[model samples]
Target: MKIFIKTFIFLIIIIPLRAYPQACCTGGAPLSSSLGVISYTGENLVIDFSYDFNTMKDLYAGNSQLNDKQRERSTNSTILRFTYALNNKWAITTVLPYVWQEQTVRSNVGKTVQSSSGIGDIVLLGQYAILQNKKNLVLLAMGPKFPTGSTSKTDNEFGLLLPPDLQPGTGSWDGIGAVSYSRFGIFRPTLSLYTLFSYRYSFQVGRYDGQQEYRFGNEMVINIGLTDSFLLKKWILNPSLQFKYRNTQKDENNGSSFPNTGGSWMYLVPSLDIELSPKIYLHSNFEIPIHTDVVGTQLVTSFKGNIGINYTLNFKKNKAYKIKD
Candidate 1:
């Protein structure tokens, strides 16, 4: 039973990331866990607000590093997530984000800054609980990623079409498929473990000028992690650690594929969650790349950080909600 619980928790905790573009690197992998899906409730409505920061400075070609060339990119994203339980076994989630992106590149004319800001792609998912018990959970989720963000944003200073990597949106529709399973108390009652797998399939989109088509490469991610909760007098402290392996296929443009636009990456993430009260929760995560192998030369993220807060409203009149330690 203990081995089964450990294996189960190792596989389910990683599948909760909502699909969205992040950072300046066009091919950067999405965060493995964006919402509190691993720790959730039934018959309750949850609202989450989060902020993400990513910085890019290193340039890599294939597996070799090149000079930075005084080029840098940064992205700041604000996201809102709504999760509603239709009932005990069914739930739906919606995610909306606003992004601010900036890229600085050195040119013969000097250094120039290109930036864009607006709404990003939206994601909707339906979640079903395949199994739920006091110490284990199995879930299946599927979702459609919508192209509600602006793809044709222009840089007024350059008077040219900025590269797709610097855009706020991918401009393509996509689909997400995910599976997760989690188990608790493998070692101790306060210890939890989970693992998850997610895949994002991309559909092509035509540029606003009708001159070319841009398609973000398909993405696959696998994650495994564990968390332990410590009880305080009035506060619950939870710390987590996760490992993620992500791969992205090469992107296509106007029927031609681009190199250096997609590759495989591995990340180590550490996070913390605090339950301030029964209805309020706060979480934060920091991610660092452990290894990266790209198809061609591209800029990669150096580090990423995110923080979020969630508010839960319980509508189960007959049951009193309690925060778990």
Candidate 2:
């Protein structure tokens, strides 16, 4: 009877994990649309807002016999972002997300399930341009991530099952630093290299339960872009490759043991930007995870894609106005 009870508890924990699969990267692509907002800022301060929606589904079979099988799991999320350029060299951005997730499991004994929905983490970031040159190159940006989301709720069955890294509200502070360089090459092709690093440490406070100390291991993202601009045509095509590496760390029930869950991932991202009018344009990109270590054997079977729309409101200066009209 004791053995059966322990097995039942284990199954409960595994079921939710199998259902959610864990979310690694933030929704959409690696590059932020507002990253370059300051570069094009005019008078009156420019503001841009974007919305993205993503949907993912997955099915897994544990063994060859297919006896240990799981049905499909689906997740839908909507993210809204806003950016405001303070000047030509600095800007601030924020993202708010809402997620709806569902899980269904199937076995010889029949089927079991759970589901939940809530507001995800809220991230506030700032960008600063350190250097720029009109003809050849530019270097910019870095910021911090504040814990504005909630973390107190933990549903053992359904609802927003929190990952170790994102527990709704981490109740801790974190910092991120990044630098990107874009250079113009021959044939009008632009080459850009971006590198980013982030770290977060959680304090044992409030409803932290035990002396569980949580720390986000070092995380890095590298992106290389090949972009081309066509003369007279308001269109730009950028094909890029992104590489990500994350080292995991966890400590619970004191400082006895902490296992490492490190992994690397790579994706191919292609983006197209077109100008609809003078300063209005539509941008979109498809990011497909091609290789990964954290995904295990189910890498291909489980993948995510993002689509977003951005609207830029550019500011213009009034040259005719005099100081004392």
- Best TM-score goes to which candidate? 1
Off by over 4 Å in 1: 1-41, 107-109, 317-325
Model 1: per-residue Cα lDDT over 92-168, one tens digit each: 88878788888766544345566888787787888777887788788778887777877777766434455566666
User: Which candidate ranks first by lDDT, i.e. highest?
Assistant: 1
**Candidate 2 regions off by >4 Å?**
1-38, 41-75, 154-169, 189-211, 231-260, 295-301, 317-325
- Candidate no. 2 TM-score: 0.68
Candidate 2 lDDT tens digits, 1-325: 9867645764765554444343343311222322332344443333334443333333222211122335544445566666666655666766666655544555545555544455665656676666655443343445655556555554454344344422434445555555555554545435444443444333332335644554433455555555554434555433444443343333322433333233455566666555465444555555565554542212112444455555555566411100000
Q: RMSD, each candidate, Å?
A: 13.0, 7.5
Clashing pairs in 1: 9-193, 9-194, 11-195, 12-181, 12-194, 12-195, 13-194, 13-195, 260-296
